[model samples]
Target: MGSINKTDLCWGDNYNLTEWYCNASNSIASKTYNCPYGCPYFAYACKKQNDVCVDSDGGKNWNVKGSITFANSTRTDHCSEISTGPVLVEYYCDDYGRIMEAYNTNCACNEGKCTDYFPICVDSDGGIDYFTGGQVTTSTSTIKDFCGNQLYNYTYESYCDDFGNANYKTYSCPNGPCSLVNGSGQCPSTTSTTGNVIYDLFKKVKIAGKVIQGIIS
Candidate 1:
C-alpha cells in the first residue's frame, strides 16, 4: 500500500490538479493534469460601470457619440459630435487633435463685416473721374460757338451717386460776340473791303508764288 497526495489549482474560471505518491525512503513522484480549458493565471481585471469599460492595456475609458458602442480597444477610436448654429466664426478640433479656426461667410455680411464702398465714374466722353459728396470739375476744353465769335473755354464737372452712376454738367462758351484772331494775334476785318484786308490778301498771294518757285527749282 502507498500514500497518495493530490492538489488542485484554480485560476480565472479554470482548474488544474496534481497527484503525487511517496516511495519507501519518503521520496515522492508527482504528475500534473490540466483541465479541458487552460487556466490563465494573469487575466486582467476590468471594472465595468455605466455600460463602459476601461482598456486593460491602455487604462483609458472608451466613449462613443450618441448610442453607438465601441468594440475595439484601439487608440485611434474617436467620437464626433456636430452642433449647428448661426456662427460668424467657429473653432474646433480635427481628427488629429489639432485646433483649427474657421469663418462662416454666410453670416459675415449679416454681422456687418464689410468694406467701405469707393465710388468711381467713367465719363461718356472717354474720361475717368472719382467723386465724393459734392460735384468736382474734372476737365476743361476750348470751343467756338455760333457767329464765329464765341471763343471760350468750358469746364466739366461730375455728379455721382452712391451707386457709382455719374452725370456730367454741360458748359458752353461764356464769351460771345468776339472777333477771330489771325496768326499774328491781330483781329482780321469782317468787312469785305478794307486796306488791311487787301494788303493781307496780296501778301498771301506773294507767299504762294514763292513756294511754287521753290518747288519748281
Candidate 2:
C-alpha cells in the first residue's frame, strides 16, 4: 500500500472569485463563497460564509482545532470584522468537516470580502462646465466641456490616464472677451509672433529698403 495523504488546508485566489480551489502555483489560499449576511468594516472586502460551515476567505482564516464539539447549526458558521483591524470572528470547519470552531483569527491579507462587485461611475467631462454625469454623484471622472461656464468661456486640456480616461485639470483664459467655436473656446489674440509678423507686415508694405534694413538692425 502507498503512503496516505494527510488532510490539507483549503486555498484559492482571493482577487478573482471565479477561482474556487488552490493549484500548485497558488497554494493555501481563500475559496470563493457567498453568505446571507455582510460584515462591512475591513480594509479589505468582508469575508463572508454561507449557512454552511465553509470559510470563503479562501481558507486564509481557517485553522486546525482538533478538539471541539461539532455544532449542528445553520448560519452559525460565519465570519465578521472585529473593530477596524485585520482580525475576523471566523467560523470554519475544524478538520472534521462539519465540526466548526470560532476564533478571533488574524489574517495577513483581506480580499473578496464585504461589498458586492459593481461598476463605479465615470464622467467624461472633468467638471460642471458641462452637465455630463447629470444628477449622479458617483462619477469617478467629471464630464467637462472645452469651455467653462458660458458666462466666461475658456477651454481646457487634461492628461489621459493609463486606461485612456481623461484626468481632471483647469485653465483660465486671457481674462477678456471669449467665445465658443465648434465646442472649443476661442479668445481674441492681442499679440503676434515676432519674426513672422514682422516679415509679413514689412515684406508687403512699400517701405524704403534702407529704412527696413535699419529698422530690423
Per-model TM-score, in order, reads: 0.16, 0.21
Query: Which residues of candidate 1, in runs, are more than 4 Å off?
Result: 1-112, 121-153, 173-217
Q: How do the residues 27-144 of candidate 2 rate in per-residue lDDT, one tens digit apiece?
A: 5344544322321111123234432334443242343212222223323323455565443334444332343334443332233122222223343343333222222123264433
Top model number, TM-score: 2
Worst 10 residues of 2 by lDDT: 193-202
> Which portions of model 2 show Cα errors greater than 4 Å?
1-11, 14-144, 150-153, 158-163, 189-217
lDDT of 1 by residue, 117-207 (tens): 2224433323311111123232343222112222422223234434445444322223322232321111222333222111111123233
Candidate 2, residue 55: how far the Cα is off, in Å = 33
Best by lDDT: 2
* Cα lDDT computed for each candidate against the true fold: 0.29, 0.34
